[model samples]
Target: MSGTTLLINLAGSIALLLWGTHMISSALLRGFGTQLRQWLGQNLTNRWMALACGIGITGVLQSSTAVSLMATSFTAAGTLSLAPALAVMLGANIGSTLVVQLLSFDISIVTPLVLLVGFIVFRLRDDSRFESLGCALIGLGLMLLALRMLGATLGDVEGSAIFQLLMRSLDGELLLALLVATVLAWVCHSSVAVVLLIASLAGAGLLSPSTSMALVLGVNIGGALPSLVNAGSSVARRLPLGNFLVRLSGVLMLLPWVPLLAQPQLLGQLPPALLVVGVHSAFSLVLALLFIGLTAPLAALLTRLLPEPERVVDPGMPLYLDESGLEVANIGLANAAREALRMADMLSSMLSRVLQLLRTSEQANADEVRRIDQSLDLLSAAIRAYLADIGKEGISDQDADRSQEILMFVINLEHAGDILSTSLAQLAARRLRRGEHFSAFELGTLYPLHREVLESLSLAVTVFLREDLPTAHQLVNRKEVVRRLEAMASREHFRTLREDKSAWAESGDIFQRLLRDYRRVHHHIAALAYPALERAGERDINGGLVGDGLADAPDTIDRKEPEQCAS
Candidate 1:
């Protein structure tokens, strides 16, 4: 009867644990996903911040593996930089320790209360904040309840002859236990689950201390292996996986060095289960501390494992992600996507400047513009090729989608750059052919307007990146200013044509051509503004343009929505 009772409890606990964790993890992921992507785009200020974000994500999700895989895939996609991804992976190792800490404590008492409160909120909207809160609470409650039940069941079955024989059967065969643990972790697709199993067995005194330690080691190593396999051909991804294994190496080595299964620390004060988890997490912390200062050097080595990037290695990641960046776990993909986005931003900014230069017609300025244009082309081609190479690994569906979007965005902007690059020299030639061109006042109106349009471009890219709805809305008013100013200038030109028609009768063809060229330049600037404004979701900026048969556009941006104001 006791054996049957224990079996029932174990089954129930496992079911509850899995369900709760699933619920909470889903909620936390949804709540933070876009913001996480934003952070990935920005890539935290430095390595430490990346690590902290990784830890925070794993702590909330209760799964280090999830964070690591996400970061790794992002690295492959060229979204996140390699170094920050590695740093975050390191922090994820720390955050996953929280689960062990929780399981060590007595949490069964409040499980019922948590479930009751959580159920009350779960009925809310699927994406509502309250619904997410309920999911987290319920998941926590269920996991705690499971741990309590497992402890009770194990305590009841502790003295079973069958159990004792089975555990003692593996006595000194630590290698076998490690292999078993690794296989179990891979099969279950969760190291945390394996940890729980080992914890329960140890608590029942069914497994010896050395065997339990080996099991812990196996669980850690196995948890990271799947992602490594998934990385396939991505050097950026492989580097971080290598870093994780190397960090795990310290723990693996330490286990064999640990003394006496019968000692006080091993069995008397610290139970086998506590020792198992404590050893794994403690060693991770130690490894991080040991290697924290060595990050730059380690990063260089890991990065060296990959193909050399086209750009020179500066603190800036013009080419690839650092391995230290992806080690944190699930945050990998988002961070990598962000890096790709940043490169795209730089390219867009360069294109805008090229357009501004085209509006001017000086020989020196034209030459400078040519150099900048070549640089933009080289960088854009490099980034696009980089994203393509990175995407071959098993990146997540979302990240793959993001890659496609980013590629499309950059390609369109690149076309615009190409347009401007060739036009500048021609504009300069036309001015020289016409001989000093117009009055100083005419150049003043034209040049200042061109500069302002280019200056305004800085704001549009800022709005797209920041997702600032208010700023995006402000762009509409600014566009209006551009429109009226452009109209006023055209009117002034027509007046010049009427009043000075006789003086420039021979330059008649130049007048019409110049007017058409200038108007087209303004039209391109106005076109760039639509993407930023539409992303804000304020008004259909391009709906009017589209209705007038200008361009085919999507109703919503793939990853953004500005509720109330903007994210």
Candidate 2:
């Protein structure tokens, strides 16, 4: 092949490597992002666990940059402490070299077989996760095939004058060589690809071991660029910045010794490709060992540098809805889910305050109810706007369903807030203004029903967060219990009005209105569970009929009540 053709082939091989790495990373995230995130959260009790989590997660993702982004996002959300996050980065750096180590071996023979199996699995599987797993397998196969092709192309020029001239030029200028490799890595958005390319070149005798080692140093530093540039918040930037600094320090410490270590008689006894891979792995391990102890102080410095900004009171802003995440569907959906959770929290506060207002006559409590009501309105509006801006083109059909679920869930909560604030708040205020004291029997009837509604609201929020099907079905059943309580309470109130006018004069109107509104609130809360129930096919979403899947389903209760008590 001509020099130009060989060069083109090499370039194509590099692109292939990058494409393969992207496939692996994106697939891993789509398949296991939530589970990995939960595992990381559960294990990050200390620096050591954090380090282990980072290593294990990065090894699975096959991309340290992805792990860094995950850590940085958690830090920004305040779900993770900075010190442990920094430790995770240290371990992630070490985990990234595993790809290089695997690629250095002679696994090219299995490429076709892997690709065949991947294609079959992808073609046969209907689930997104399974399909994504197939995609990952295909990507790995492509990477191996690209490595073989790259090696063949580079070997063709082993004795050429151009190759000799290029090597001679890079032989003395190690820093210049490092710059080239670093730029390549940054542009590719993958240090694994860059390291693999350098190893292939070294194995083919197109580049010496010393040159490859210098390039590996560049790869380490360049690997951090993507995370740093992508981080929109200071909290997100701190973890990646700390990671880069650790790598920079390690590189500086090893710079003077590169030449000494590169001498064939000293440390080059292994094959050229193996030496390059070994050096990359050793450098990462060194970074982890040297910096693990200093993570706390390092985190402190980072915290001092990027101190959490005083939270601005933007009631209209969506706290977790990051626009940058919209480019990646899973991440954007996760952000939307978190924002939905925040809304649920506000709704929970509103419910608690409503319950408080029912039991107390404090002016401060009434004011808090009004204040939280307004906040809920602002938060709900912000959530809708945030969801509107998220593009649907990239997300899977399942994610589209999730987005709809969040939208509907938030809308239900907002409606429930309006009920509590407008209807329930008004009745409570009227009762307090009248200076009325309820009889012991009346108070007894209201308290139990109120507590049950509160419990349903809490459980509904749980169903929203967890999508627990069994609990969702139970929540639907609880809706029936609430209906009975409302009916019974209304019937007792009417009997009191007929039999004991003096007692009725004190709390009758307020008590009736409160029961009606509380039942309305329960209806809204129970509505949140219907989506889950519908997804499980336990209920027909449109007709409100229970599905045949239930072997011993409860008989559907008639929910109609007396006209005066109707919500």
Candidate 3:
């Protein structure tokens, strides 16, 4: 083969390999990404367990980069700590070497057969799981095929002058070899692919033992680059950077003596292909053993290197709306739900302040309520914009419903915040200014109503998070009780007004408005439960209660029959 053709062939084969690796990662993630993330979250209790989890997940996914990205995001989200994440990265590095070990053996004969089966399954089965399985199979077949092509392209030019010169430059200068290998792995985004390529070259006698070992070390360092580049926070970058530091330290410490080991005595006694993979695995094993016991100090050093930012006193932004998850529908939905939960929590805070304002008026509490309302507005806008950015093409039907539910929940929460900031907050400010305190009876009624609304908001948020059906039913029923309480409170206020004109003039208007605003806020809270109720097929016609097909009383807190209100 001519030099130009050989270069083109090699480039094309590498591209094919990259495409295959991407296909495998994306397919596995689409099918089981939630479970994998859950496993990482549930299992990473300590360094060793985290290391084991990292190894297992990487082994199953066949991509350390994927594992690293996950650990980084979790740490960014505060779900996984830096120390455990670092342990996982070490395990992932070791897990990645398994791919190289498997690829070293001859399995090219099954490539065509796997391709045929994958094509048939992908064409015939329309299920997402089966489709993903087929895509993974096809990707595996293509990866094997790309490896074969790479070997063929290099084998043809083994004795060419250009090839000899290229070999000579890397042979004498291990540092240059290390740089080349690092760049190749970084660009390809797969250390396994790059290491396998090195092993192939070593196997074909186009590279020496020491040169291959240097390249392997470079590949390990390069493997850490993608996660670092992709990380958006200090917490996310710390673990990957630590992993890179460990690998770099190991490689540099061993660099001077790699030539000594390659002197046909220590490591050179093994076959060339085994030597490459064995060295790769051994280096990772050594790193794992050394760093596994030092995770505490390592974590402390990383903390000192990358300190956490000071916590905001009054956070006004979305905490979990990660843009990276937009391409993955389930992950994006989970992020949206979390942001929605934050909004609900803010609403609860506002309601609590409203209750406190009713009992004891304070300028600071009123000011805090206003600030929280502003925060709620900002968060609502962020979540709406985030949901808009998520592409609808890939979202499953359930996720589409979830997206709509999140949008509706945030909208209702925003409306509820407006009720507090405008209606309730102004009333409290007026009361504080005029030195008007609610009557003892009025306070008694308002306290229960406020407490119920706060509790319902919490439950609605829970339903949004977990979609718990029974809890949702109880929330819907509680709305009716709040209505009755409001109506009874209104009746007592009017009865007092009739009995004494003094009470009516002193507290009548504030009493009526308070009841109206609290009931309105409750309405918004109750509305949040509707989506869950509808999904469970338990929505009532007029009452909006979650029960079998019985029409409810007209949805009104307007004074019920006096006995019914009392009930």
Candidate 4:
């Protein structure tokens, strides 16, 4: 064959190989990413089991790189822990070796047959996954068939004088042989291809068995380049994964004599391809066994060394909703999601308490308010972190909607806490500075109403959680009455504010603060009514279904001049 023809075939074969690998990887990801994540998270009840699962998963996938990348993505998203990911990384190493072994077999004899069948299925698009899978198989078959042709092409040129001269220089220098092999394999992003090239060269008599085996060592070392480089750019805890690569590859090459047994006479009779696969897998497994047990100590060290990574507010944490973590058990999956929701609720509750504390005139109250505000902020941060984790998990459409809604609700709750703490609390403080307290009669009129309004809000939340349609319906009817009563109480207080200018000057700020907070809390409660209605399959309460019963509501709070004091 001409040089041009050889080059074209090689390029075409290489492209098809890369493309096929990509398609298969994506299908595996799309079909199983979330299930995979959930399984990793909740299913790894023990370290040994985690290691086993990791190995099994990676072995099945045929790409340790894929497993590592998936684990890195999960760690960054906050869904996966460093230990579990490390466990998978170990398994992935073993899994990746499986690919080389498969390639080593004489599957090429049947390659054309598989390719023919694959093409027939590929054209059938009704089952898109099947079609994709068919195309992938065809691509694989073509790459294999290309290897045979390339093997023949090289064999034709092997006994030539020029080839003999070239072989003399490369044969003796193991490092040189290793370097060339590494570069070529790195270029292809495939150690399997590297091993194939080695096998073909040895088979064609282009290179001696010893030299070909030396190149296999280089192939394994080269495999680490992509993953090691990627690890540098990964999250802090995942640096160890890259470290695993550097250690594995470096150790194998440094101690090659023990493992490679790279003798030309020995290499000549053995299946060089199978040797490549075995050595590569064993090298990784050795590394995993040596290091996987050290996962916890390593994690602790990384934590101690790296410090806490700075978190940003933008692209929130990815939940373990991806295919990696979710394959364990259905109950475990639901538990993780619900825990995320519960965290959100806890944040909302804590934030509410902080806001309530902020609404005070006493200096003592102010101190407590500030402390609670800081606590609320911390809770918000924690909830946000948990949300990032849940986002990484595989979610059903309904779960996705619920997850987003819960996140949004927490954000709103956080802001509400901020407003109350900063604005309402300050007003309360200023009123107390004047030494006036809630008037006895004013308390009598407003306190019971406030209690009743809060009780109603409590009832609404309970009904929503329980999915009680009747209770929700009844709560809808009472909201109007609560609004009327709130308005009436506001008037009675306003009348008191009007009666005594001196009193207004003294406690005006406190009175206004209380009224504003009372109204704002009521508004939040009112807003929750809709969610309750939604739970019950009712129309939006804010829409016409509730009618104009509360239509005369003051769009804005009435800030009119005070009148005669009722108190």
Q: What is the number of backbone collisions in each predicted candidate, taken in the order shown?
A: 33, 0, 0, 44
Local distance difference test, per candidate? Answer: 0.60, 0.75, 0.79, 0.56
Sort every candidate by lDDT, greatest first: 3, 2, 1, 4
Measured by TM-score, the strongest candidate is: 3
Residue 91 CA displacement from its true place in model 3, Å: 3.2
lDDT score, candidate 4? 0.56
Displacement of residue 527 (Cα, Å) in model 1 is 12
Candidate 4 lDDT over 1-567, as tens digits, reads 566775676566556544555555455445445654566677875667777877786554444544554566656666678766666666666666666666556766676887787788777767756776676567556545555554454454454566567656787677788787777666555565566666656655666556766676677666655555555443644544444454555556555573246554553456655555555666767777777787677766665665655655322233333333333334434444444444334334433443333333347655555555555556556555554555554656655545454554445445545655676566655655666555555445445445544455565556535646566555556666556656676676678778866665546545555656656655554554555455445574445344323334334433331221111
Error of 3 at 61 (Å): 4.3
lDDT of 1 at 95: 79
Compose the digit string of candidate 1's lDDT tens values, residues 510-564.
Answer: 4434444544544454444455444445345435432222222223222221121
Error of 3 at 493 (Å): 20
Give the lDDT of residue 550 in candidate 2: 28
Residue 515 lDDT (model 4): 58
TM-score of each: 0.45, 0.52, 0.57, 0.54
Worst 10 residues of 4 by lDDT: 558-567
What's model 3's lDDT at 265? 76
Which sections of candidate 4 miss by over 4 Å?
A: 1-19, 34-168, 203-213, 231-233, 236-308, 313-459, 462-485, 489-567
